[model samples]
Target: MKIKSAVFVKGVVGPDQILNDGKHKIAFIGRSNVGKSSVINSLLGKKGLVKSSSTPGKTKEVNFFLVNDKIYFVDLPGYGFAKISMQAREKLRNLILWYLTSPEIEHSRIVLIIDAKVGPTKLDQEMIDVLKDFGHDFVVIANKSDKLKRNSRINQLKIIREQTGKEVILYSSKTTEGKNDVFSKIFE
Candidate 1:
């Protein structure tokens, strides 16, 4: 289950034909600066495929990437702590909520990314609650695991697991740690 090919498809902000295109979608979501784009790029084994940024909230729309010509890897906007205006941030928040709760769209899986060193935050918990309420299958990815020391990494993973109530995979987009584990979970 390797990603042999990937290409950016299109970005949408509201209901559209792409939502019902019958392609299995794997959505990546998390708070701002959680490295969601970097994680997606790492999973695809491409550096610039997903357009990562140091600043948060760069992803303003629901960007879809066609992976292996079979499934769609949806890069959703980061939820919290963006430099954007209140109205813009609210729109992004609503867009994320709609995508997650919409009945017309079927997600094969959702990847909830959290900062490894920071653990899960308040917004992450809200997203988790929404996922639970909607009965969506999801996995937690603790990105930036490389930033933590060995003992800190263990403790952080434990804390994240306890908080998220889901197995948290320690991932490093820089070192590609846990890349195989992530791939298995995403493609399983």
Candidate 2:
């Protein structure tokens, strides 16, 4: 997709604050430091469009980015960061849940970003379960593919697919290998 105009919309903390204009929303979610922002930047064919950070829990609010003025690429806060307090984690979890299950959610599909090297964590599995419970099928992006060997990457992708029962795109934000694939699913 040729992104002629991709601009930051707004970051909201609650479901009620999500854009209610009836635009199709393709949301990105995962554990903290899983390269969610980087994946967004890669998909948009631009750098610094979504801020990438080394620290965990960099994104605290649900961010909305308007893409080509057609759909909204929602950048959600990541889960499962130990550095944050338990209260904060619970709040984030609740916010994520509300955004997923709430009827106001305009999400067409969610891109669940996972670390290619670390594979899916327990919390990641839990999120998958919640999505399934809501009858929402999501696309899984195994990010940071450049961190692992070719064989290991294949094995990890297989494992993730078997576990989630969903498509897992082999992705590297650094190389933008799976950038088009991600957008294809989103724009399909």
Each candidate: RMSD: 1.0, 1.3
Candidate 2 accuracy as TM-score: 0.95
- Clashing residue pairs found in predicted model 2: none
All candidates' TM-scores? Answer: 0.97, 0.95
- Write one digit per residue (lDDT tens) for candidate 1, span 1-188: 76789999999999999898999999999998799889888888888988889888888889999999989999999998657899988999999999999999989999999999999999999999999999998989999999999879889999999999999899999898999899888877
Candidate 2 stretches with Cα past 4 Å from truth are 15-18
Clashing pairs in 1: none
After TM-score superposition, the amount by which residue 163's alpha carbon in candidate 2 deviates from its true location, in angstroms, is: 1.1
Q: Candidate 1: minimum summed lDDT over ten consecutive residues — where? A: 80-89
User: What does candidate 1 score on TM?
Assistant: 0.97
Off by over 4 Å in 1: none
**Model 2 whole-model lDDT (C-alpha atoms):** 0.87
- How do the residues 4-77 of candidate 2 rate in per-residue lDDT, one tens digit apiece? 89999898886454457878889999999999988888888879989889998888888889989978888888
